[model samples]
Target: MSKKRNLRPEEIAMLQANACMADNWSSVFVPENFDIKYVSHTRFSGEVTLGAFNKEFILPGGLKKHAGLRHVTLHNCRLGDNCLIENVQNYIANYDIGENCIIQHVNVILVDGVSSFGNGTLVSVLNETGGREVPIYDWLPAPLAYVITLYRHRPQLISRISKLIESYSKEISSSRGSIGNNSRITNTGTIRNVRIGSYATIENCTRLENGSVNSREEEPVYVGDSVIAQDFILSAGVILSDAAKIVRCFVGQACHITHNFSAHDSLLFSNCAFENGEACAIFAGPFTVSMHKSSLLIAGMYSFLNAGSGSNQSNHMYKLGPIHQGIVERGSKTTSDSYILWPARVGAFSLVMGRHYHHCDTSDMPFSYLIEKDDETYLVPGVNLRSVGTIRDAQKWPKRDKRKAGLQLDPINYNLLSPYTISKMRKAVEVLKNLQALVGETSEIYYYQNTRIKGSSLRNGLALYGKAINKFLGNSLIKRLEGTAFSSIEEIWAQLQPTESRGKGEWIDLSGMIAPQEVIENLLRSIEAGEITSLEEISAIILDIQKHYYEMEWTWAYDMIESVYGVNLQTITAKELIALTEIWKESVVSLDELLYADAKKEFSLTSKIGFGVDGSATEKMKDFEGVRGDFENNPFVLAVKDHIVKKEALGNELIERLKVIL
Candidate 1:
């Protein structure tokens, strides 16, 4: 503890005159050489520390306001230097207001009782009824929440993790809250049990209760006019403005919630933007965005997902309550007005373009299209591999990461095709082949899970799925030997040796972080045994596992080759490698061609119809060129063309090298 100081005679007189009554007036200390010129109309009680306030503060638009109290009541609060706190409608209590903070026109600010600022608040995330409630904290990341929300089958593990958080929250619980340095709170209605971080800008917010704003200088969080939040943790770089209502939520880093968007019991991760929509009991992973006004995301798990206008889900049947939940994997999208009845699983990087009554489990067939045809759902598997939209989305997500924190909490894996999704595709191919065998190959349409897969669609889907699998395997092989100079077959075999046995089985996508399932199990076992406790420690383990992903992936992929592709690697010939390379080259070129055609649609004549209004044909053409530019010259289009050329060259170069060895 620091030494206490005695108050001077004039300061004691001022303290006496202001009706300040502490254990001792001399105990109400200030910094040495503290100025008293700005001390006026203030009441202090209990053990209060006062910094000098005799400084002129510049107001907005060149106006100036002197630092002095006027018509405000404070109880057990410390006033920092140069702060302009005036006109409090009610009272400010149990707060340690930091230096240069401006509080004006606030109704009431109080700690009330011991509070952890929304820490350990139970958010019933995946299931609202109870069993999967995640105790939200200021540092809660998406991948950690994913484990807590979904891995409830391991009860001992969940209990140990929950115990760690509970103890952490207990340690930080206090009767006093802090409004951080340089914060400006004006025209706020009520702030109760909230811990505002440094440089936060809370202006005109109607109500803020039971939350922690984890703002910093590098990434200042903003809560603007008429915003209301309760039992929430607004992370660094978050902006909640324009009447957004958040309750029982964990808003992750760099998230933007505006335009009166409402969310309850949802965990929105990094870079998710929610505007004019509603989300309830949803687990929104990294980059899950919904911008339209009429969209509603409820009781689902999603990552890298975009909910189009009027996109909605139903978790209830008339027979039971809203008990069902769904998973829309990373890079998936729903078209305008698309709806899905819950207990459904949409695959990774898929496109859902229509309402589907039947609960289709497309988890095994990623990169597919779910379309409605004549009130029946049509499943075109693996078609999204060629979609320009998928390619564009993949290209943009990395560039769009808005997190500015030096310590990133979420370990994101952005691979479009990894062992996680490739394994699913391998299963899907078998499932489709089984369907074709069960129902005669000449059947006009085959039925599975109450959806129709037409004969031609099935055939094409099989071909596309095969191409994708071959591309992934070949790409993995090339990447594994990218820098190695294998002069002999023995050297090539040596390069393929497994470095670790950890990745030998299934792979799982825990929201955005993909790793081998065995690794996750190992983590869970460790958590159950109380080996990893801190949030930072848990995140470090996850990142460490993700760093060794490729080695584990090869372990899984090596076993998959014999079972799925019907190839034994121990007895493989040079001709098989050449054949696989040729097939991979074809797949890459075909998909690039498909993407090129799809991209061209963006700059088509129809796209230019509205660009040049009230102009002649040549003028309209010039106007279109000025704005949208020519199709072939577009940067993405050019990149696609270049990618095709480069990939072809790479494949040919490898093939020529392989010929010398053969």
Candidate 2:
């Protein structure tokens, strides 16, 4: 609370001579060191509190303006020390402007009545007709939102979580807004019921209403150039600029939205990027990106996805409203001009090309390709396991993360081959084998899940899924016994035993965080029982699950190894372990060879067509080499070669160690 004091006689004389007027001079209060010369042509109404103006601010292009209040109208506001307020077209009311802040050319910054500042705003994500409404609030984690949006089966849990968020909204509701210290609001228009944080920059924005910018000194939020946002919460390190329009959204940490991109009723989590496209009623998980003008993502759930130009989806059948939704699982891609009807579920790490009207569900078979030919959907399962683009995407997502400083709300796991996907591969192998058995071996085409699979594709898919499952199980085994030296069968069994027993059943990818399903069920039960009632407690529980991922993962991998390989670890010998290591080495080397061959296709002569236009063949070859370097020396190619060598040496080392026990 600022102390109010009566003005001295000298101060009143100076104020009169400086052309400053107040409705009632007795209603205004100033600090002891306030100077009347710095305040001119300013009108004060209602009860105003003024602070000292002692410093000068250096604007852009080296122009300087001393800290003062000039040509402005302030009502029931508090001005902090060394702040500059100039050229307010209208007035600033009911705001506590902080120290060293700059407010110039702003119109009407106020809180009309009471506002919750975008908390408790129900955003209908994933489904437009509204069973999956997530009441967004500050500090809403992706895992928590996942539960709120998808877990409708547990009504008691959802009710308890909603009540907690509503209670938090009521606790922070206020009638007076605030602009924090060292912030800048220049050339913006109409900010209402918004809370600005320290070190934030709001420039040339058209309008902002009912929101909170959670910026800080470490990482400031930037809202630039004609952006209009309503009922939104922009998290720390976020940048929304270039005429973007957002409504009823929560933009999470380090997200970049610009170049006229518009989003409505969406929830984009940490590290996502959107530009030149439009998103509606979508739940974008970590690292989701869409950067083309013709792309439209509507009524879908996606994560680690890349949308190409002219990619689209239809959520309505023309008979009903936009009520259907789709799920493109993690690490998927859509090629240019591709389309899918809603109520479909695309498998993880897959690619979609062409247009298909039939709704398909391929959740059991991951890493496949869905291509439309002659209006028929063709499913090629497990072929993406050898694509170079998949490998590159997995490698680049962690490097491209832009969240340098902030408390990250999403717990992201950036593994291309985890227990989640590997389990799907195991199921895929079983499905392919079953299809071959049910249909005769001479059958040319087999149909499953509203798609056609060629006979050749089924055999190749079985081979690919087999190799991948072997690789994942072997990787886990080697990691578990990497450093230990076993001299006897009992010693080998002891080393192979799992450290924990919690991850034996199904595992799920909750947006970005991957964990056991049983663990999530236990948390839901606790929430329904009222033992976990606060957002902080829920976040802590999620963090604990992430922290113990490896321990739980090992428990699951041990069971998988026994079930897939038919190896009884309790009675296994050193010779059997050595044979398994050899098989692991073969699988690793085979996959690397396939990736190497796939990379070579990019450097072929057919890819060098337009490199050297109107030139000889020699010149074209030279031009192609200059732009796209030789395949042998490319960075990704070199990494692949190095990976093969390292894996071979590791497998050889482990086999040699096991030979001693024999």
Residue 585, model 2: lDDT of 94
Model 1 C-alpha lDDT per residue in residues 1-662, reported as the tens digit of each score: 12335688877787557644455564466767665555556665566676666678888899898876666777778767767888888989999988888889999999999999999999988777667899988887677799899988888888888888898889889999998888889989999999999899999999999989988888899999899999999999999999999999999988999999999999999889999999999999999999999999999999999999999999988667878898998889999999998988898998999898889888888998899988888988888887888888888988888887486767788889899888888898889999998998888898877678888888888888888888788787666656655566666667766687998778888888898888888888888887886867887888898788878888877777666667666666556767777888998888788889889888778888886698898888999999888888999999999999998988887777667668
- For candidate 1, the lDDT comes to 0.85
Task: Give the true-structure RMSD of model 1.
Answer: 2.5
Q: What is the lDDT of candidate 2?
A: 0.90
lDDT of each structure? Answer: 0.85, 0.90
User: Which pairs, if any, clash in model 2?
Assistant: none
Give me the runs in candidate 1 sitting further than 4 Å from their true place. Answer: 1-4, 14-27, 54-57, 65-70, 79-82, 561-576, 615-617, 656-662
Q: Write the per-residue lDDT of candidate 2 for residues 323-414, one digit (tens) a residue.
A: 99999999999999999999899999999999978899998889999999999999999999999999999999899877764477788888
Worst 10-residue stretch by lDDT in candidate 1?
18-27
